[model samples]
Target: MSEKARMTTHKLFLLPDYEKEGEYLTKMHSVGWKLERVSGFSQHFVKCESENVVYKLDYAANNTNYPEYIKMFADYGWEHCGRVMGFDYFRRNADGLSEEEMEIFSDPQSKLDMMKRVILTRMTPLLIIFFMGILPNMYMIVVNSMNWDRSTLLFLAVLYLGVFALYVSIFIYCIRGFRKLKKKYTE
Candidate 1:
C-alpha cells in the first residue's frame, strides 16, 4: 500500500471572518488538496481528485451534545470534517447543489446568531484582556517611563505600541466584519 501525499499549511483567520476561511478551504479542495484536519494554525491536507465541494465553518465553542450535533449535520448531508478552536468544519459535494442548498445555515438569522456566538465566545475574552489587562499595563508603563533611561524607554514604547496596535486592529476588523455580515444578512 502507498501513502497519499500530504501537506500542511499555516493560516490565521480572524474570528469575525471565518467565511473567508471556509472559502479558502473550498479552494484548496478544488485544487486537489482535501483538508483532513486542523491543529491550531496548521491545516493538514491529503492529495485527492479535484471535486466541487462547499465548505462551511460554524462556531460552537461549548456544544454539550457533541454526538447529536454531528448527527444533525449528517442528516442534512454535511460531513463533519473536523473541529479546531471551537470552529466546526463541515463540507458537502456541490456538484449539482444550488447555492441555497449548499448553505449549512438554514436562515439569515441563524448566520447572524452564529456570528454573535463567535464574538461572544472567542473574541470577547481577548477584548476583555485588552481593556482590563493591556490598557492598565500600558498606563503604568507610560507613567513609569518618565524615570527610565532613553534606550529603555524607547524599547518599551515600541513594544507596548506594537501590542496596542494589534489589539486595535483586531477590534477594527471585528467591527467592520460584523457590520458587513449584518447588512448582508438583514437586507
Candidate 2:
C-alpha cells in the first residue's frame, strides 16, 4: 500500500463540558451521523464513509452529562466499536486545551513505560561492546603482557580507551535526549 493510504490521521473531539449526551446526539444526527458507545467514559466511535472516529467522553470536573448523548446516538443506529476510559499515547485531541494540558492528561505510566524501553535500547549496544570488544581486548592485553611488547600494550590501551569514550558519548547523548523529552512533557 502507498504510504499516504497507510497513514491515517485520527482526530479526537472533546465534547463540551456542560453539554448533555443527547445534545451531542442531536448535533451528530443532524449531520447524518451517530455515535456508538463502547464501554467506559461514555466514549463513542463516529462512523463516516469507511472511517471510524474515536471519541473519549470525559466529565471529570463539570461535565457529567453523557447518557443523553448516548441515547441520541442509539436512536440513530450508529455502530460503535467499544468504549475505553482513556486513550493510547498516540491519540491526538482537536480541542482548545493547550499543549501543556495535553501533556498532563497523557498517561504517566505510559510515559514511564516508554522511558524504560528507551533506556533498555540505549544499554543494549553498550553491553554488547563491553562484552565483545572490551573484554576480549582486556584478555589480549593480559596475554601480551607476558611477551613484554611495550608498543603493543600502548596501542591496546589507547584502543580500549577510545572504545570506552565512544560508549560514554553514546550513553550521554541518549540520557540527555531522554531528559530533555521528560522535562518538556512533565513541565
Candidate 3:
C-alpha cells in the first residue's frame, strides 16, 4: 500500500454476507484498487498497478493453526489481505485461473460449514445482545413513550434508530446468508 491511500465508508456488514463482500472486493481490485485495511466502517484501499485481482473471505478465527492455515492458502496463490472481526480476507491476481477455479473452497459443503461456524460463533452473540437487551429496551421505550407526545417519542427514538436498524439488518442478513448456503450445500 502507498502512503497516499484513499478510503471510503461502505455499509457492507461482512458478517453473514461474506460472499457479497468478497465479490465487492474483487470488483474493487479489478478496477486497480487493492484493499489495504478495514478500519471502523471504512474500507481503505491503495492504488495498485494491476487489475483482475481476485478477493475471497473466509472464517479463520476458530482455526487453531491460523499461521499454517494462512500459509496453506498462500501456497495456493491467495495472499493474506486482512481481517475484520475474525473473518479473514484474501486476494490473488487472476493470472491463470479459469472462472470456476477462482473460489477458495473446493466445495459448497465446506463453505456452508464455515458459514455455520460464523453464525454460531459470531452472529449468535450479536443476536443475543440485540434481542435480549436492545430490542426489549426499545420496546419499553416505545411503551413508555405512549404516555408522552409524538414529538417526545420521536426525539427519544433517534437515540436507537440506527442501532435498531443495524440489528434488524444483521438479523435479516444472517438468515438470508444461512439460507443461501444451506440451499447450495445441502441440496
Per-residue accuracy of model 1 over 1-187 as CA lDDT, tens digit each = 9999999999987777689889999999999999999888889999999989889998866889999999998998999998988899999999989878899887998999998988888888888988898889889888998799999988988998999998898899888998998898899
lDDT of 1: 0.89
State residue 88's C-alpha deviation in candidate 3, in Å.
0.4
- Clashing pairs for predicted structure model 2, backbone only: 21-68, 21-69, 22-68, 22-69, 38-82, 38-83, 39-83
Backbone clash pairs for candidate 3 read none
lDDT by residue (tens digit), candidate 3, 164-184: 887787688778878876787
1-187: candidate 2 lDDT, tens digit per residue: 5332121223332222112333344344344344444333444445433322223233222225656644544453322333343322112222454545333236765555555544554356567867897778777787778786788778878888887787777667656666765675476
How well does each candidate superpose onto the true structure, as a TM-score?
0.92, 0.37, 0.78
Ranking by lDDT: 1, 3, 2
Reference-based lDDT, each prediction = 0.89, 0.46, 0.80
Q: Per-residue error at 164 for model 1, in Å?
A: 0.4
- Candidate 1: worst-modelled 10 consecutive residues by lDDT: 12-21
* CA deviation > 4 Å runs, candidate 1: none
Cα error, candidate 1, residue 174 (Å): 1.8
